[model samples]
Target: MVEISIVISLILIFDSYLLGKCISKYFNWNADYFPIITIGFFVILGIFEFFVFAFVKFQFSVYYILFVQYILLIIPIFVAIKVKVNLIPTQKELKMILGGALFTIIFAFLMGNQTLGEAAFDSNFYLSMVIENSTSPTLGTINGYTGNIENISTLHGYQGFYYFHSLLLKNIRNILSLNNTSLTPVYLWTSALTYFYMLSDILFHSINLFLEKKSLHTKIVALFFVLVFFTNYFNISFPFYGNTWKTLNIACNMLILYEFIKLNNKKSLFLLTFLNSSLIGFSSSGFFIACFIEISFFFYLIWKKEQNYTIYLEYWISCLSLLIFALLYFSGNYTKISILILAIYCLAGYTVYLTKRFDAIFWKKLLQFFKFIFLISVLLLVIVSYFVRNSMFSGSDSQFNGYSFFFRLNSLGDMTLNYFIPVNKIEFVRNCVFWFIIFINCFQGKYEKEYKFFLLLIIILFVNPFVTPFVVKYMTSIVYSRCFEIFINPFCLLIFYTGLIEWLEKNKNIEILFLLALEIGSIGIIVHNNISYYSKFFIPQKGYNPVYRVTNDQWELYQNLIEELQSSKLERPLILNQDIAVKAYVSNIRVLIDANTSRSAPAYSDENIDAPSDWLNIFYVRDYYGQHIWKQDPDYSKICDAIIDSNCDYVIMDKEVVVLKGDLYLPLWFDARGCSEVIYDNDRYVLLRVRK
Candidate 1:
C-alpha cells in the first residue's frame, strides 16, 4: 500500500508539474515557483476532471481520467523540457519546503491514526461516493439504505464539488488494492498533506513578496505561518477537517486572491477569471468568497483608475459562463436562480462600464439609470426571497442552536488571541505589548495601502462570527459558525504575522526572542491538544458517550458483520444505524441509508428525511426505537409493509440502540411485524434478516 501510494503521489506531482510549466510560460512566472504554481494547477486539473465526468459525460473510471490527463500533459512536458529555465529552488527554500512537508506528514499521521472526530462521517460519505463512482459507470448516490442509484442532481447540486477529493482517494484505493477501511487513514494523511503544501507555498510566496527577502529566516517564518493556521488546536479541534472539499476551495481562493493582487497581465487575468469560475464547481463557500473577491477587485480597479475595460469585459464574461455552467451542473432551482441573479449583477456592472465609455443624452442616461435600479431591486428581492424560503423550510439542530451572539463573539476573541499569542498570562501580555508596537509601526505609512487592506480583512473576520447567527437564521439550516473558524483563522494569523514582521524589521533585538517564544508556544499548544484528543479514546466507561470515538472492538465487530453479509450474498439493501454507517459503507455494501443528511439522525422527521419512501419508513421505525411502539400508527404499518415487502435484506444495530432506545422495542416490533429473522446477536451489536 505504501509503495502504491508513493506511485500515485508521483503521478499527481508529474501531472501538476507539466501543467504548472505551461501556466508559467504563459504568465512569465519564475521557474523556481513551479511547485507553488503546481499546487494551483492541481486544483485546476481536479476541476477539469469533475467537468469531464459530470457535464462531458465521460466514463467515471480512474484509468480514463488519468489517460486523458497524461495525454494532455505531453505538450507541456515537451515544451518545458526544451526550454532553459531555472526550475531549481534556492537552498533556503528547499529547506522550508522539506521542513513543512515533514511537519505536515507527522501531524497528518497522528490525526489519521487517532480515534475519529466529528468529520469522520463526512469522510466516510466521500469515500463511499468514490467507491461507487469508481466501480459503477454512472455518477449518482448509491442510496446507502436501498442500494438504488439515484441521480445525484436531484439529491444535491454540489455533488460534483467534492468529487475532486473522492477521485484522488479512488485512485489511491485502486492502486493500493486496499479496502475503504484501510484507505481511510491514507485519505486523511494525503488530503491534509496536500492542503499543507498548497498553504505553505502560498505563505512562502506572499511573505517573500512582502519582505523582499527569501532567506532561511523568511522560510522559517513561512513554516510558522503554515503551522499557525493548519494545526487542529487553532481550528477548534477539527482534526478531520482536511477530509472536506472546502479546504481545497479555501486554498484556491486564497491563491487566486494573491495572484489577482500581484499580476495584471492578460494571461494572468484570464487564469484568475478561470479560477473564479472554477470555484462554482467546488463549494458554495468558495463561490461566495470568489464573488466577494471579484467584486472587490472590480471596485479596486475603478478606484485605481486603471481604465482596463478589457479586464471588466473578461470578468463579466467569466461571471456569465459560471452562471450557465451552474445552471447545467446544479439541479436546485434556487441555485440556478441565484446564478442568474449574479449574472444580472455582472450585466449591471457591464452597463456601468458602457455608460462610462460612451457618452449618452440625458434621456438615454436616465433610461439606463432606471434599468440599473430595476435590476438592483430584482437582485435584492431574489436574495431576500431565497433567505426567507430557507428559513421557513430548513430543519434545525439543537447542537447548532443556543449559540448566543455574545458567546460567539467571545469565542472569536479567544480563538484569535490563542492563534497568535500563547495562552498563558505572561506570554499573552508580552504578545499584547508587541502587538501595540506593531500597530504603532503600521501607522508610520510604509505599505499604507496594504495595511489598510489587512485592517479591513481583520475587521471582517472579527465581525463574521457575530453575523453567523443571522445567516443561519435566514439562509441556511446548518450553523456556519464552524466555517467562520476555517476561513477567518488563517487571515487573523496572516494579519498578525504581517504586523509582527513589520515590527521585527524595526526591532531586531526582540526578533529572536519573539520567534523562539512563538515556536515553543505553538508546539506546546499542538502537543496539548493532540494529547487531549487521543485521551478520550482510552476512558474506561463507555455506553454511547456523546464523544463517540471508534473503538477497536467496534471496528472488529463491524468487519465481522461485513463478512457475514458478504457470506449471506444478500440481494436487497442493508439498513445500518447512523452511528455504524461509516464503517458499514467502508465494506462497499449497498445500504438503505448512511448518515449524510443535513439534520441529526434521531431528529429526522417525514418532511426532512432524505431517503427512499420504503427506506425512510424503516428509518422512522428504528428512529423511534424505544418510544411507545407506534404499531397502531399509519407510519408504523407503512414501515412494517416496507420490511415485509423486501425493501431491506439485513439490519445492523449497534449497542447504542439498547442504551438509548432499549432492547425491548426491536424484539417486540419484529415479532409484532412478523417480518424479521434474527441472524446475528451479541452484546455490542445485532443483525436482522428482513423477510420478503
Candidate 2:
C-alpha cells in the first residue's frame, strides 16, 4: 500500500505542475479573490512545516517527515508568487490561519465521528485523522476502534477517490500518534489542521489581491472576514458544508493557476500542477470530470491563441499524470469518464483550429475526421443517456433511498439549488455573469471569436437541460461532479472578462454594473439559504430532517457501548461487524471483522438484503443450520465441507443490520432445546456464541 501510495504521490506532484500551467495560461487573476488566497497558503505552509519538524524530531522518521514537509514546501511557495513585495510581513495572515486552527480545535475536542458531536454531512472525520497513517486502510464507519462492520467506500460517492483521501489521512494521523497512546489529541490535531488548510486556501489568495503592501493589520482583517463570512455562509447558507469537497480545493487550484499565469515560471507551473492534482484527488472521481472540462477549455484557449500544435505535449503530460491517479481510483465509471475528458479537450482544440483559419482541402479532410468521431460520441452518449434518465437519482449505490426516473423529473428547480446558493450554483452564476459581461463588451477585437463561442455555449447549456431531461433526468446526476462542468468555461470567460474589464471600453462601468448585479444575485440566493436554514443550528431537530442528526442521547449510548465492550472479559473473541476490531489497537483483544467492512455487505443493503443464511453454509458455520449458525464458535467439521468455508471469529448483530433486527442474535434452539450462550446483550446489540 505504501509503495502504491508513494507512486500516487509522485504522480500527483507531476500532474500538479502540468495542469497548473495549462490552466494558468487561460485564466486571469481576479483581485477580489486573490488576497485572502495568498495569506491562506502561506499560513498553511508555515504551520504544516512546524508540525513536520516537530513530528520528525519526536519520531526520528526522516522520510515520513519529509513527505509532510513537501506539503509546506510546495504549497506555500506557490502562494508566495502572489506576494509581489519583499518588504511586507506575512505574520498577520499566518496568525489568522492559526486562529482558525484554534477555533477548529475547540470543535474537535467536543466532536467525535459519532452523531453526538457530528454535524450534518460532516461525519466525525476523526477516522480520517486516525488511519491516514495506519498500514491497512479500509473504508466505512466501522474501524478497528468500533467493531461494527462498515463499508465506507460506498458511502462517499466512489471508493477509488475515497480511499486515496483515507490512506493519506490515516498515514498522517499515525505519524502523529507514533509515540503517544492517547487518541483524543490526535483527533484534535488532525481536525484543526484540516481547518488550517481551509484558511490557508482563502487567506493566502486574498492577500495576493493587494497591489502594494498593505498594513499587516489590514491584510489580517481582510483574511478574517473572508474566512468567517464564507464559513458562516457555507454552514448557514449552503448544504455544501456537508457534501462538497471541491469548495476549498477548487479555490486552491484556481489560485495556483492564477499564480502560474502571473509568474509564468516552471516553478509556478509545477506548484499549480501538483496542488491542482491533490485538490482533484481530494475528490477524485468527481474532480476527474472537472479536470476533463478544464483540459478541454484550456486547449481551446491555446488553439485560439498559441504558437503551434506542438504545445499539445503539455496537455498529454498533465492528462497522463492525472490518468495514473485515476487508474488508482476504484471505480470503473471514473476510468471511463477520462474518455469523455479526452474527447472534450481534443474536440475543442480542433474546433478552434477549424474556426480560426481556412487551410483548404488538407484541413477540411482532417476536420471531417474530427467531425466523424464527434458524431459517433454524441450518438453513443444519447443512447446511454436515454437509459440513464430512466434510472436517475442520488444514492443509487447506497441502497439508502435511490431514486428512479420519475422522482427526478418531478424535481426541477429543487434539484440544483433549492433556490439556495449551493457551491454548484455559485459556480453557475459566476460563470454565466462572466459570459454575459465579457462577450457583450468585446463586440470586436481578440475576444470576438471566443465571445461568439460563449454566446453559443450559453445557449447550448440552457438547452442541455431541456434536452437531457427527456433522456438523462437530473443535471447533477454524475454525483460529486458538480464543479468542473461549469468552472472550466467560466475560467475561459473570465479570462476574457478580466482582459475586457481592464480594457478601455466605451461603457466600462455599465458592464461592471451588469457583472456586479449577477454576482449579487448569486450571493443573494446563497444568503437566503442561510436565513431559512437558521433553524438547524443551536436548536436541533429530529432524525428525519436533512439537517437533523443523531441525538445527543444516542451518541452517549453509542460511546458507552464501546466502553462497556472494552471492559468486558469475553476473551476478545474475534468480533465481526463491530468497533472492537480496530479499537483492538488499544484494548488487548482481537476482533475479527469491522463495521468498516460489514456495513457495505449485501445483507443489510437496502437494495439487496442478501441472505445471511448463505454465510452459515459458506464457512466454518457450515452444518450449522438456522439454529446451529448461532451456536458457540460455529462448528467446522470437514475442511472441505459442502456448505461452509470462510473463516471468521464472531458476528456482531447490531442496529446497523435489519436482518439482526430482533433484540438478539437469533434464538439458540431450532428444535426448542437451548443451544447457544448469550455473551452480551443490549437494547442496541446482542452477542451470541456457538456451542459445542
Candidate 1 displacement at residue 167 in angstroms: 4.2
Q: In TM-score terms, which candidate is top?
A: 1
TM-score, candidate 2, is 0.49
lDDT of 1 at 256: 46
Instruction: Look at candidate 2 and tell me the lDDT of residue 509.
Output: 68
Question: In order, what lDDT does every prediction score?
Answer: 0.48, 0.37
TM-score for predicted model 1 compared with the true structure? 0.69
RMSD of each candidate relative to the true structure: 7.7, 11.9
473-493: candidate 1 lDDT, tens digit per residue: 553334233344334434334
Error of 1 at 372 (Å): 11
- Give, for candidate 1, the lowest lDDT window spanning 10 residues: 410-419
